[model samples]
Target: MDSWVDGQPADSLSLKDRGLAYGDGLFETIAVHDGQPVLLDRHLVRLADGCLRLAIAADIQLVRQELLSYAAAMGEGVLKLILTRGDGLRGYAPDPTAPGRRILQGNPAAAYPAVNAEQGIRLFPCSTRLSHQPLLAGLKHLNRLEQVLARAEWQDSEHAEGLMLDQAGRVIEGVFSNLFLLRDGVLLTPDLKRCGVAGVMRAEILFQAESLAIPTQIADISLEQLQWADEVFVCNSVYGVWPVRAYAALSWPVGPLTRKLQTIARALLDA
Candidate 1:
């Protein structure tokens, strides 16, 4: 693995970086295959959008070029792009003139659980609930303590994932991926207006589903409603899409619709 910090040949970043100090940064984890990044444009767009929302000055072209160079060296791996508000003084108020710093790191993608892809996954309902914060709901910001804590609540290998609920007890998403449930032939996902990282793969799935004429909705979901879902799936850019075969004691098939979506998702990535 190799890394570049602000175009410099360095392996370590300043501990005083505002990102470290105040979590004032955004990041994107991209999947690379066959010497190309899957959904590169979408990831870049989201990163740029996050910069805009946070009042950070980001050079999209430069970032893209750096990512391509890093990917070329990596061959096949996951690329992590981080943009921080740079080092700042003792106060919380940021200096409007300080230029942001960018870091691009590449590492080999971890081997995924093969059985999960074929047979499907089993999930647990985590006791930890997500806090509602509209301001940080959709951005892939550095504040991930919530997910860390939620994931720590379980150590069982059989539990492939943990389903999280919002402060209102509404089912929101998984520990590291977006959640979707199928009910009465319609697909439903939690609205990110309250809290959750708006995953790149989630956006792609929603868009492709619309194009395929699949009925989909973004709404609040209760645990009761989720328990009745015909099928369930969790998704992220790196893992693509994984069908949830069991949640608690409830089980489901890897349904035809989910298989179809997975096909499209794989094709999109491999394209």
Candidate 2:
């Protein structure tokens, strides 16, 4: 693993950093292959948009350059970029003039077991309900207590992911990825306006669907509707895409739509 910090080694972070105090920060986990960052521009766009939504001062170009440099050094791995509200006095209100901090870290890419991606993964429906906070709905910010709690609900190693529903029992997304279901030959993903991270891979798949003239819909999904879908898959930039073979007792095949999306995703990574 390799890392770079904006401050002194001992001054890793001050106790006054607002990010630690209030989760006032954002992060992006990117995939690096053959010394190149995958979907670099897309990740930057999302990161910049997140900073804007949080009112954080983040220069997209600077962040991109730093990420490229770090990724190049790491060669092939996972690149993590963390932007946080820099040091501040003890208070709930942020210091308007405080400088922000950026930390870039790189590590060997997480080795996803090939059989899981090839065959499929099992999912357990978590009892944790995602809270609807439109203000923080789509941004990948630091306040991830909901995901943490949801993930903790299941300790079974057989379960690769947990499906989380909204407070009203509407299917939202997975703990760390976007959810997409194939129903009656159409692709459907939950609307992110209510909750969940609007993942970069989700956006890429949506764009590819439009380019390929594949029918896609963004709507409010319910568990009952999901149970009847032809297939299910979860996606995130780091993990690419993986079909969901089983969610509780409900089962699905790795259908044509999933293969089509996977092909497109592979092409994007190759590009």
Candidate 3:
């Protein structure tokens, strides 16, 4: 399928676009099923929040309409929406009133081995660490050099994902997913206050946990804490949930809680 720039079909963008120049933008990777975008409202809420935080002037209503139209045409696939601060001059200072540029690219659904979710996956201990940036911690912004570097640390099929830690040696998340662990029946996830992308799936899982009456905690996680976990799993809006069986030498089983949440996540994604 052809990509759309704003509301029109285009394969090219302006050379001076700020998203290309300075990475001044936000993006959302949405799942489309049966010609409808899954978690559409949640994705938009995150996009709106990012625009607000970055002070990028974007037309949310127009974006929503474009997404609906794009997803309807896509039918079944993934839709990536990029909102940039239009084009800009050669500088760091941004034009506060510039309307954001919207680009929609469609792709087929992600292809991951079923074993990663069924039997569990091995987590590569990434050497790359996330930097501390409180202002941009959870926005799913365009600047992703850190993740790019981290992902490049692995190049083998032996590992399904990589575990990323912050500079302070606190466990943060995966290269492209949010992580969660269970201990003593309490679900715990690393706090993204200082860094890490607050993934849409992570938010949904938290809400689901609450509705299920499961206790969940968001805190600074340590390597020591991960070693003590009864069950560990990673999640993203695309893959849903993947149970982490091993990270380096530490290992964990796909516990009952992880399986329970995995079922719920599967239902949500497949819906």
Question: Going through the candidates in order, what is the number of backbone clashes in each?
Answer: 0, 0, 0
Point to the candidate with the largest TM-score: 3
lDDT string, candidate 3, 120-155, tens digits: 999999999999999999989999999999999989
Better of 2 and 3 by lDDT: 3
lDDT of 2 by residue, 136-178 (tens): 8989999999999999998977888899999999999999889
Q: Which candidate number maximizes lDDT?
A: 3
TM-score of 2: 0.94
User: Which residue runs of candidate 1 sit more than 4 Å off their true CA positions?
Assistant: none
Give the clashing pairs for model 1: none
How high is each candidate's TM-score?
Answer: 0.96, 0.94, 0.99
lDDT of 1 at 262: 82
- In model 2, how large is the Cα lDDT of residue 219? 97
Which of the two, 1 or 3, has more TM-score?
3
Q: lDDT of each model, Cα atoms only?
A: 0.86, 0.85, 0.95
